[model samples]
Target: MKVTKDIGVWTGTWLLLWSTLAYIDFFGIGGISLDTYFFILSFIVVFITCYLIAKAFYRTPLQKTNIVNYKFIKILFVIVTCIYIPILYKSLVLMTNGNIWEYRAKAFGSNDEASILFGNQNLRILYTIFIEGGVYFIQFAFLSLYLLTGKKSYLFKGFVLIFVMSIVMLGRSPIYYYALLVIFTIIYRSNGKLSLKVPILASILACVLFFLSAYRAGGEITLSYFIDKYIVGYHLYGFSLFEKSGGANSFFATSSWFGQATLGSFSYLLLYPFSKILSINFLYFNSQEYLLKNSFIVLNNGDEANAFYTIFYDMYQDFSWGAPLIYGSIFGIVYGIVYKKAMLRKDLNSFMLMLFFLNVTFGMIFRNPLATNGFVGFFFYFLLYILFNKIMKKRLHV
Candidate 1:
C-alpha cells in the first residue's frame, strides 16, 4: 500500500476544509464576505503554488537511521511518567478544590492572569513545561513507536496521559492536538494511504470535543450550540479581524500592522518558552494590543472574550497582502522539503520533526501551532531523539 509522498494533497485538503467551512458559515455566524473570499482564495493559490514548486525539487534523504529502539523508548516512557505522576496528582487536587473554571478562564483571559494561576510564577512555569509540553513529546514518541511496532498499547498509553492532562488543564486543545497527531501517525504508517475511517475518526473526535465542551460549561450543550460557539465562532472572529483591520490596506497604512509583520512573531513562535526570562526587547512584539482591540469573541451570554483568530488572521495582520505570497510560500517550501525526508526516506527523526510542521499545517483552521509552547516541546524532543541516536550509535558502533 505504498503511496506518493505528496504533502500538497494533505495541506491543500486542510486549507480547503477551513476555507469551505468559512464559506458555508454553517450556523450563519458570518459568511465569507467578498473581501474575505478574495483573501482566502488568494492565500490558498499562493500556498499551493509554492508548495508544488518546492515539491518539484524533492530528493531522498542520504542518511536514514534505525532510531526506534523498543527497549530505550520503554525506559524513557517509564521515566517520564514517573516524573510526571506526582505533578499530575497535584494538578488533579487543584482542579477539584480550586475554582477550576475561573482558573481555566484566567489561562485564556490574558498572559498576566495566566502567569499567576499556579500560586506563583515558578510553579506555573513548571506546570507548563512538564505537563503541557511533556505530554506532547511523550504522545508523539509513543505514537511513533505504535507506528513502528504496530502495538495499540502505545497509542492507548499516549491517549490516557493526554486525556488526564486535558482534564487537569480544563481545556480541549490538547485533545485536538493528540487527535491530529494520531491522524498524522496513522497516515505515515500506512505509507500515505487514506480510508473512509479517517473522516469517521474525525467525526468521533468532534463528538468527544462536544462532550468535553459541555463538561467544562457544567451543562448539557446542543450540537447547534457547539457548532455555533466553539466551531463557527472562531472563524467568524477571524473574519472580524480582517474587517476591523481594514484588510490588506492595514499592512501599509496601519502602524500596528508593522509589529505583526516583523520578525517579532517568529521570535515568539520559536522561543516563547524562554522569552519570559530572557527579556530581549527587540525580539518581542506586542501584537496582543492589536488582537485585544480587533478580535473579541461574542459569548452567548452577551459577554465578550478573545483568542482563536484563524491561522491566517495573524499572518494577515502581519503581512497582509504578502502573507500568502511570502509567508505562505516559505511554509510551503519548508514543508515540501520535510515531507520528502520523512515520508520518502523513512527517516525516523525527520518523521517526528515533520509532525511539528504538520501541526502548523493542520492548525490553519485555528491558530499557528508554532506560536504555542508545544512547538518548543516538539523541538526539544526532536533534539533529544538526535542525542539519543548518537549515544546509541556510539554504543552499538553503527
Candidate 2:
C-alpha cells in the first residue's frame, strides 16, 4: 500500500546476504583455502531462491490498526510470568554437581564436548525443560503482547522476562531473537522508514555478544578469532576436509530418507509441545536420519561436535543433492504465499510465522525447520489471538 519494505522483504534480503557470505567463504575469500565448487553452487541456488521469493511476494507492511483485549494480554502475561519466574529462580538456586554456568559449558561447551552426551541425561533434561523451554514461550509472547499494547511498563516487563530466559541459554538464538524483536519493533514504530544504520549497528552488537558468550569460558577474544569461529557460522569447509568423508556430490549420489526428514519433521511438530510438557524427548520428531548424518559430520571433522549443518544440509537430509535448488524454490513459493496472505490481512500471526522462518533461515541448519519448531510457538500465539479476538466487545484504538 506504500513505497517501503516489510518483513518478507527483509527476510529475502537476509537470504541474499547469507548466500553471498557462503559464496565468498566457499571460494577463495582473501586468500582462504575453503574454496569448493559445490559450496558456490549451493549458495547460487539459495540466492536465486531468495530472489524468486522477493520478486514474487515481498511487499510493504500493511498500514492498519490492530486491536486486542487488554485483559487477555494481562492474563497471558501473568500466566507466562508465573511459569518462568520460578524456573529462573530454580536455575539460580539448584546445582547439578556444580553451578549453572559450569553445567551449560560442560554439557554443550567446546571445552568439554562430551558433557551433555555423558552427564546425567535425567538432570540435563530437567534443566532443559525448566530453563531453556521458557525462551520461546515467554520471550516472544510477552514481547509481542507488549508491542500490541504499546505500553512502556509492558515493554520493561518484557525485557525482564527475556533476561530471565537468557540466564540459562544465552547462546546465539536467544540473543538473536531479542535483537530481531527490538529492531523489528523499532522499524515498525518508524513507519517502515528506519535507517540502515540502526540495524547495521545492532548486528555488530549481536555478533560481539555471540563471540563474547563463546569466549566466556576462558579463551582468546579478538576480532580475528570471532571471524574465524562463530562469525563464520556455517560449516563451509564441510566434510571434504576428511579423506574418507563423503563430499556433497557423494551425498547426492547416494539415497537418503527424503520424506522422513521433510514431512516427518512437519508431523513431529504436532507432538513436540506435548512431549516438552510431559518432560520427554521429542526425538527431533523421530527423525534419526539427522543424528546419523551428525555423526558423519563429526567424523569428517575429526571432532566432538553435533552435526548441525546449514539449511542446504537439512534440505539435503530431506531431498539429497537437489536440496539447494528445487527445495529452496519450494520454500520460496510456500513462504511467498504466506507473506502475501498475511500482509494483505494485517495478520500478526502471519508476521510471526515469517519471523520464525527467518529465525531458522539466518539461524543456519542446526535444527529442524522453523515450520516445526517455530510453528509450535506460533500455534500457541494463534490460540491466544483467537481467544482475544472473540472476547473483545468492540474494536479498540491503536
Q: Per-prediction RMSD in angstroms? A: 4.0, 6.8
Q: What are the TM-scores, per candidate, against the unseen true structure?
A: 0.82, 0.66
Which lDDT values do the candidates have, in the order given? Answer: 0.64, 0.51
lDDT (C-alpha) at residue 317 in model 1: 60
Kindly report which residue stretches of model 1 are placed more than 4 angstroms away from their true locations once superposed.
1-5, 23-26, 62-65, 68-76, 106-117, 191-204, 234-236, 249-253, 256-266, 269-295, 299-305
lDDT of 1 at 145: 68
1-398, model 1: which lDDT tens digit per residue? 44443566777777777677666666454445566657777777887887777767887658754755545556656776786677567666765676657656654334554432355666665556545666677776777667667687877898887787777667787778778777767776776787665677788888888998987886698998888677766545555444444554443434335333333334555455565568654233454534454456554334354555555666666666666677767877887777767656665566665766666676666555555654565556556766877788798875
Clashes of each: 0, 0
Question: Which 10 residues in a row give candidate 2 its minimum summed lDDT?
Answer: 27-36
RMSD of 1: 4.0
What lDDT is obtained when candidate 2 is compared to the true structure? 0.51
Q: For candidate 1, what is the TM-score?
A: 0.82
For candidate 2, lDDT tens digit of each residue in 1-398? 22233555565566555545554545332211142345435645574567566647566556454545445555656776776666556544433445546766564434334434234654544444433433454454455554455555644565566665565444454565566666665565456667774568587756656554664544556766556545453333332221123335454524465544554334565566787799886444445544454463333223333444444444555566666666656666666666565456545555555455555554443444443333444455557666677656454432
